[model samples]
Target: MHLLVCGGTGCRASASDSITESLKERLQEHNLQDEVQVVMTGCFGFCEKGPIVKVLPDNTFYTEVSPEDTREIVEEHLVKGRQVDRLLYQAPEGGRVKDSKHMDFYKKQIRIALRNCGFIDPESIDEYIARDGYFALGTALNEMEPRQVIDQIKESGLRGRGGGGFPAGLKWEFASKNEADQKYVVCNADEGDPGAFMDRSILEGDPHAVLEAMAICGYATGADKGLIYIRAEYPLAIKRLKIAIEQAREYGMLGESIFDSPFNFDIQLRYGAGAFVCGEETALIHSMEGERGEPTFKPPFPAESGYLGKPTNVNNVETYANVPVIINKGADWFSQIGTEKSTGTKVFALAGKVNNVGLIEVPMGTTLREVIFEIGGGIKGGKKFKAVQTGGPSGGCLTEEHLDTPIDFDNLLAVGSMMGSGGMIVLDEDDCMVSVAKFFLEFTVEESCGKCAPCRVGNKRMYELLERITQGKAEKKDLQRLNNMCHVIADTSLCGLGQTAPSPVLSTMKNFWNEYVAHVEDQRCPAGSCKDLMRYEIIPENCVGCTACARKCPVGAITGERKQVHEIDQDKCIKCGACLEACKFDAVTIK
Candidate 1:
């Protein structure tokens, strides 16, 4: 019997480490330590149901278990051969979530991009090997030629999952087609998208998956050296990747002739200084070469002239993770999974106002309804779903009108949203659309590499217009100016960083124009999110003047004597939301 404990970053925050240790202690106490393997595994995509403890052989899935439950789990399940049904995942309808394979959330997910994520103990090389981790590399070395490997990927129709949707095989063919003494394979782990951790989690949960895939790429493109351009903020992913690389080197899987083949390749980690624009291929190459992180015009794309003017191929973490799967199972098998254009499943960290918040890997053509409802379990608190934003800060918002649309590269673009690194942020009716647009604009303004005036100045100007509108200081004419500027920025920007900056504004305006109009025409934020246009008030009947709201007010804005009605001083209230959070009387409100 095996017990897999979640060791992903999100679960780690919720004290999953304590749970793992406690489970071990319980196993030892019950004398089941040797019989049962308490394995620390990568993220189980059902993060909302973690810290998860999944018992294998039976696949008895347990969710939201505390350290205390560890004792009961060990005693009852391990000792008595009975399952802890209560600890099992709860379905959306409130009954127990199924333990059987058919009923699991993973049943609905086609995990091509996330094949090894939840299955393997990321830190251990043996566990990765047990699950056929390096089999593809072995097969590639002994059985297939370099050209054949590239052909399999080409036949798979696999495109880069990193927003651009460029064909993976085409990119590899470009590099392979050229002959160079010193070529390089790069993994773009510089995930700077707002609410996007698809790549980050893959690196954290299955670092070896990428490492192995990079080795495969090295063999395919005849590159001896590889580099991973990961952000410095992802210390956990970096640490795991470092361990995986060292382990691969030791095992003769990564360094020197792997599987005794005539190939020697190794990967080095490159730390990105947290620049959002550096996710671009050219900018990533520049950073790797010890230069400033900024993108140059493509055409002499990274496949041809890249990384010290050598032939280089770059694929984001998600793209590389798919390599082993394609090689082992065959590209024809992968091509059958998703739609014709977008083959295989995609891993997404479903976040924001969704009911079930976690990582999800669904087929490419799955409708937004299935993602937001069937898998996500719908919006939280029964709030109406206003929109779902895919593709991070650069991607635009999709409203209920577009919810039925199938999710793929072309389909998303047709609706004004691009696949920007798989950050799907669900917004509710309570969330002000104008504010949402402004927030993304702010991120772009801050993260812009300042390579061109369009992104540097134009984005800041657009943000200023959004700020003015939100603060009730601008006319409707300002909206026109922002829209006009968006077009120019999209057209004039050098790289994708500047070109896609206007997406949030354009998408929000297209879908939620009413909210923007209401804010501008009536000088009222319907969502009550704009602090400048809102005033907090305490209703006399609702307030018992219990001094609760007053005491909770951090700004000393609430004033009343004992049991009398209290009033909020508008000037003093900074709208930190402390009073609202503390209020049990339902007295505090924003206009």
Candidate 2:
């Protein structure tokens, strides 16, 4: 039996390394070192229950494993062939799940970009080779012409997974057609979405896959040099990528004349300062060229002139992760997976309000309901489902009406949201719509490159308007003004950062008009999330003459005699909810 422990950043932080060590020591003590192999692999995507330990042969998936559980795992599972009942993954429905494939969290997930992530030791090139890692690059370099390779990718119907669902094959063809002395292929690993780690996780888990795909892209685009512009914040991913690149070079896979062929391609790493705008191809190219990460107008698009003014093709990490797979697996095989328009799979960092918060990949046509209910294990704490925010800060909030909508590029766009690097944040009824809009606007406002007036001034203005609405200080007519300003920002913004900055406000206003109206017309926050819009009241009958709230009131907001019903002075109340928590009787309530 082989023991695979999650070595990804999340699991590692949770002491998965110590778990691996303990298991190894126990294995040696039991004289099963040679018979059983303990391998530390990448993330398993079920992050909520990590650090994960999956026993192969039977695929007995264990979760929330600590260093102390290592000996138990070895003695019970490895030696006696009995699974550790406590370590085994228990489903939300009160049953132990031995295999991950049977769990709701992974049942609907079709992992393509993340295929070898949790299964293989990413730093080992031989392990990567065993999984047919560089075969696609070798095939393209040896047998297939550049145009033919491009044609195959086009036929696969793969779209870029890095926010914009642009056709990947078409983008490559654009750079391929452009003739220049030197050309470049770029992997945009500078993922900056607030809760999105799709790109970073892919790099940390499957670095070799990205390298192979980059080499293939270099061959197809007639680019001799490849650069990965990853954020400096991802030290683990950066280290693993550096190791993977060095291994590829040593194996004669990355350098010139690979497979005894004339094709010469090598990859290098460029670090970014984690600017959100740099996710844009032009801005990324500019950052690589030692310029500010701000975006310039795209008349001379990155494909035409980029990175020192040469033909450069830029695709994000998840997009590149799919390239080798599509090349190895036939175009028809890949094209058949999803809908006609949007093909293949999308990797999502599923977070916020969901029970099974983790990294998940699903086919393009999978419904939001399937993702939320089945794959995500439904909303947390049995809370009423409110909305889901897709496409990161730039994407819009979607409601229950959109849950059944097929999750493709066009469908999400039609619903006032785009699939922006696959950050699906599920919202519950407790989440205030107006507050949610303000939150995303705040993020966009802060992350804006400030190069264009629309993103800089307009987004700040939009954020201010959202703030007014959330704080219950806005007029009803302010909604119309907010709507108008959002359109202006979308129409006039120089890049996507400004263009989609207003999406959250517009979408929330469209879906949760009543909530916004409550905050405005009634001067109340419906979800009680906005503290300024909430009034703390003491229930007259339920108070039971409790003095606890009065004593605990930090600002002397509550006033009453001892053993007497308490009353709150709204003027003194800071809306901290401390009185509510301090109340012994169920006396305090929010109005």
Candidate 3:
């Protein structure tokens, strides 16, 4: 019997390591250590009920497993052969879900890229091998030629999971056509989206999968060396990747000749300073080469010249994670899973107002309604769903009307959004659309490389326009100016960063035009999110003259005698909501 514990970064932060040790101690006390092996695996994708524990053979899954609960898990579940009802995941409607297969969160998910995650102990190469880890590399080296491998990838129709949904096989073919004595394969692990962790979780849980895929890519593109450009912010992923690399080299999977074949491929690591612009290929290559992480014109694409001027092929971590699976299952089988154009599952970091916040993978053509409602368990606190921002800052905001829209490269683009790195942030009715646009613009403005004037100057001007509208200080003409500037920056920007920088503004203006007009013409914020547009008033009838509001006012904005009606000095009020919290009689209200 195996006791699988979630060791992903999220669980670790919640003290899953202590839980694992506690479980081991309990097993040792019962002298059942040998009988029941305790293994720490990667993320289970259900982060909402994390620090999870699953008992194999029976497939009994436990949610929010704390260190104190390990004793009960071992005693009742393991020793007595009974299940722990309290720890099991309770369904939204009623009964408890005993395992992941039955949970609504896992029902729609088809985890191809995240196959090994939550199943194997990541630190142990032996565990990885037992699960057919390096078998794809062996098959590629022994049976298939380089061209044949590339052809199979093309047949599978796997597109890049990074931001651009470029064909993976076509990229390899381009790199292969280039005659460079030294060629390279680069895995872009610099995931800088606001709510995205798809790449980080894959690296932390299944680091070897990426290494093996890079080696396979090296063979397909005639690249002898591979480099992984990952951010230094991801310490856990970095540690596991280093461990995986060392294990692969020691096991003869990465060094000189592999599987007794003459293909010599090895991988090295390059650290990024968490620059969002480096998510682009040319900027990433420039950063790897120790230059200012800025992008140049793309006539000489990374396929033709990259990383010290060699033929280099770049794909994100999630994109590479899908490679071995495509090799194992035939291209026909893989291609049959999703749509004809996008033939594979995509991993997404589902965050924001959703109840079941976590990492999710679903086949292409799945509707946004299904992912947001069924898989995500609807909005938190029963709030009305406002919008969902896909593709991070580069993508657009989708509304209720677009809920039934099929999620794919073409479909999302048709609706004014992109499938960028799979960051899905769900918003509720309480969220202000104009504020949301400004928030993303703030991030883009801060992270801009300043290489192009359109991104540098144009984005700042656009951000200022959003700021004025949100502050209830803009006229109706500013709305048209903001709209016109969005197209200008998008058309004239040097790289993807500048080109897509205006997406949030354009999307919100298109979808929530009334909200923007409210801020401008009425000088009011419908969502009450913008502080400058809100004013706190003391309701005369509701005030009991208890002086609680007066005592709690930080800036002395409210004043009243013990038994008289209280009055609010609007000039002194900061709109901090402190008076509202302090008033027990509900005297304060926002206008």
**CA lDDT of 544 in candidate 3?**
86
- Clashing residue pairs in all predictions, respectively, total 0, 1, 0
Q: Please write out the lDDT profile of model 3 over residues 134-240, one tens digit for every residue.
A: 99999999999999999999999999999899999999999999998999999999999999999999999989999999999999999989999999999999999
TM-score of every candidate relative to the true structure: 0.81, 0.83, 0.84
Task: Write the residue-wise lDDT of candidate 1 on 284-380 in tens digits.
Answer: 9999899998898888987788999999999999999999999999998999988999998888889998867888898888888878876776676
lDDT of 1: 0.88
**Collision pairs in model 3:** none
Looking at model 2, residue 500 earns an lDDT score of 86
User: How well does candidate 2 match the true structure in TM-score terms?
Assistant: 0.83
lDDT of each: 0.88, 0.89, 0.92
Between candidates 1 and 3, the one scoring higher on lDDT is 3
Which 10-residue window in model 3 sums to the lowest lDDT?
42-51
